[model samples]
Target: MTRCRLCGSEAMASVVDLGATPPCESFLAADRLDQPEPAYPLHLRVCTDCWLAQIPPLITPEETFKEYAYFSSFSTSWVEHARTFVADAVERAELGADAFVVEVASNDGYLLKHVVDRDIRCLGIEPSVNVGAAARDAGVPTLTEFLSPETGAAVRAEHGPANLVVANNVYAHIPDVIGFTQGLRALVADDGWVSIEVQHLLTLIEENQYDTIYHEHFQYYTVASAIRALASGGLTLVDVELLPTHGGSIRLWARPAETAGEPSQAVTDVLAREKAAGLQELSGYTEFSARVAKVRRDLLRFLIEAADRGETVVGYGAPGKGNTLLNHCGIRPDLLAYTVDRNPYKHGRYTPGTRIPILAPEQIAADKPDYVLVLPWNLRAELVEQLAFVHEWGGRLVFPIPELSVVEAASSKEVTA
Candidate 1:
């Protein structure tokens, strides 16, 4: 039986099978091209017992994230998002110089930089050696190792319990969901809160975000399922917020079960809405699978037709989600000439499964392809603005997911006007 990673429930149903794929961010060096890529089964399953959505167990944290290529500081929007999160968290938790804040999967200290600026004690637990070193270089003390129950206890023993534990977009990446949450409980102080931001499954299905599916993302989360998982670890969901980042995400605030407080109305409202939407029923997942299949067909057809028309197409943003979409859709360099990335580390590399070249964003401006495929469709607005010069050559922007559409305007300013 393929049991659930969280509750060990055998009652699970396959939601979507994305087939064999390499780790999304495993961009390869030119010399390593001939090195065999280990592609694993990328299958999503929803646990009937706990309602946690997860992928079939295949890879470990050590295999996936050590010496990671991604740096949070690479994206301007992400950096701004981190800064905003730090400011808001400090204010909401009433954190001061004496209060300690801990962040898990804190990449390159992008968020903790703001916390340190406030003179508050901050520590980052990053598993990737390269990214952790970058964080330390940025003056943020970071521990380089996977965060498990043992590591959490050790951290607490060394630095004391944290007043706030921030985990942004990491709740779903862990294969051992239970262990990770237990670690949170062990590290947080009595009054401290653990804030987790995950891409909401409900939003993923509704927005046709099948691109977010990959081996690295071991699970998909919804508030109801997350609450249950947290409860199992002696944590309670006290508050929740719907965030616009990463397509659509939910920021959930939790505390130890012993803490006394009423759950936020946001929690009750979203849960009730989810229940009404039949997320509690297996039928919801079935419908989602059907919708995902349709999107795959639509995207492939559009790309094939565009190729036949001799239209030059290129991808923007070498995000993990983009890799999943391309690999699942079986897109290669022939379909997309190359993908552009702002991260210098990834620029000269090749995408994992598709082996498509990744270049600097400057390539998009210089090439000025007839069509620029916006892989991170969630940031379409921001990217379209950034590439406004493409209009000079009468090039159009294409967004495949959610729906296929060609956006044409002289410039971003003209489009808004």
Candidate 2:
């Protein structure tokens, strides 16, 4: 009965069914494990009319993100990515002190602080009261509220139009994506720009990045779906650039749809690539279902084989993507031993479905497990570097999705069976 959120089309078809996975961001306290944990289907559907791939609501925004566990400042590369984006956006926009900047879903003011350091006026719209307070402490003005059309208008009336509206990896988290995009249009000035970074759907299909599909993430978008979504909300996709982050992500630049501008060649090239990859049709979405199943099977097989050999395996990070992969494969602490995370919020907690014990990253050095399961596989490079010392103990790292393989710290180039 859930119509496509983008186009309101009734011709939505289920493409991939990850049956009843626990909420990805829901980490559990020790005393709460005895209590029952709830789960909802990660059944992915694509609109036949708009070609927008989405998941029907299994959980609400308040349930998923109000008091979130993950923090962007914990990741060094991600902070640097934000710093770089702030610099680039400021340069490209020719922004001065008079220009206002706003970031949606701004976690802990990681990006906006860079704006503030440059003496630019910055504001953050974060739904999580916890992180919003953190941003305020960090010297960035933040409003702890979910962005809606009405909220957008209020922000514009008070602060005036924003010259740069930045949303990084938060577009897919929105359930009412049209309303979210409309918020951008309602706040941005005619000459202003809105840049959104989301994981590209083409990469999700090609590289078996189904771990990125979680309950909080309502939709998966390619340039095709994103352009259509933006256009419908009164915005134009004037440019797009592919980045190596998050398996593969694309940064989309937009102006008011009525504003005069033509899409850059990068946008056209990425669209061409998506079309060549068959993203224009339903077959492309369907082909990914079998790949998801294969990843689940292969990862379980690798963990089982490692256990039989008496080799200890522990996980590296407790990211939301890791939770989906852990639940879908039904992996437990028995197979994975325990997972470690840099974020203190999750240190004493446990992963949602698989009930894997979460520990501090230092525990890995004390235990020196034979293998480390890099749960946030997208951050493989950064994690591998941080935990590189594990190699001194003859330990290797495991990349679970796309295929299960071992990477020896001694020989990072070689993939071990």
Candidate 3:
């Protein structure tokens, strides 16, 4: 029996099974077209004891993050988000020129750029060499290695305890959740704050965003699960904020258990809400597998119908979640002519498993496809607004998850009018 990764509980409940799929980033080279792709079972389960939702134990961090293709500087929205976070954190934490800041998985120095501008000492722990190189080039000193207790100790030895530790969209990617958070306890100063941003598990379930499932994202988190995980490492959650990024996300502010801060009402309210929603109960996870299967079927049916109707359907956002959704639904370039990505690195490459070419957003204007499918549905508003010119040509945007919907100019006017 597979034991829970976090709580060591054998009484785990099956949540959703996404079936076998290749790593979301394994976009093959043209020469390797004939090679067979490696696929693994993408089963997800939730621990009954600790309420942590995670994928089956299989891949290692070395296999996932090494040579990572994702660069945080690619997305304009993400860059802006990071800048805003750095600004807000500096003020809230009362960071000064002497203060030290550490960011885990700090790709391309997206947030650290802002921190360093204030002359504060900063260090970045990044696993991917290419992205880490980018961070170094951007004038941020980065250590290209995975964040573990050993690395944390090394960081503490080199830089002393950090006054601020920021981990954005990375807490879920780690497998050794306890050890990683313990490392945070080791690296952060006694009076320091550690802020982590993770996509909310409640939003995933309610919005039917099963596409976020992949080998890299080992865990899905709720406020209750987060509290449990942090408490295991002797940390106390002092604040929580609901963020609109990534469909929906939660930003948690924590510190050492010995130091006290006024816990926000948002934190308490969300915990109580999670309890009322049966997040800590076993039955909450029982029927999730069925819901996921239904989504797969519905999405496939919609895509097939669109293809039959001679729709020139394409995709937006070449993100990891987009890759999982495409691979899960078995979509190919035949169904989606190509995908547009803001990331210049991914622009010239093809999507993994699906083999769909990724292009720049300018290609949308050049081709004027009949339909633009929003893959990163979380950023649908930003994408739709940016690609509004497509609507001028009577082209519509399609979103498959939750349900397939068409956003035509007429419909847009109706909503606004």
Off by over 4 Å in 2: none
Per-candidate total of colliding backbone pairs: 0, 0, 0
C-alpha-based local distance difference test score of model 1: 0.86
Cα lDDT computed for each candidate against the true fold: 0.86, 0.89, 0.85
Q: Write the per-residue lDDT of candidate 1 for residues 7-76, one digit (tens) a residue.
A: 8889998888888889888889999999899898888888998888888668877887887887888777
Q: Among these predicted structures, which one has the highest lDDT?
A: 2
Give per-residue CA lDDT, model 2, range 1-417, as digits (tens): 368888888998888888888899889999999999988878888888888899987688888778988789999999999999999999988899799999999989999999999999989999998988989999989999988888889999999999999988889998888898989888888889999999998888899998898988999998999999898779999999899899999999999987838889998899899888878887677778887888888888888988999999999999999998988889988899899998998988999988999999999999999999898888878877887898999999999767877898655654775
What ordering of candidates by TM-score runs from best to worst?
A: 2, 1, 3
Off by more than 4 A, model 1: 409-417
Give candidate 2's root-mean-square deviation (CA, Å): 1.1
When 2 and 3 are scored with TM-score, the better candidate is 2
What is the overall TM-score of model 1 with all chains considered together?
A: 0.96
The local lDDT score (0 to 100) that residue 44 gets in candidate 2 is 86
**How big is the RMSD of model 1?**
2.2
Residue pairs with backbone atoms closer than 3 Å in model 1 (clashes): none
lDDT for predicted candidate 2 compared with the true structure: 0.89
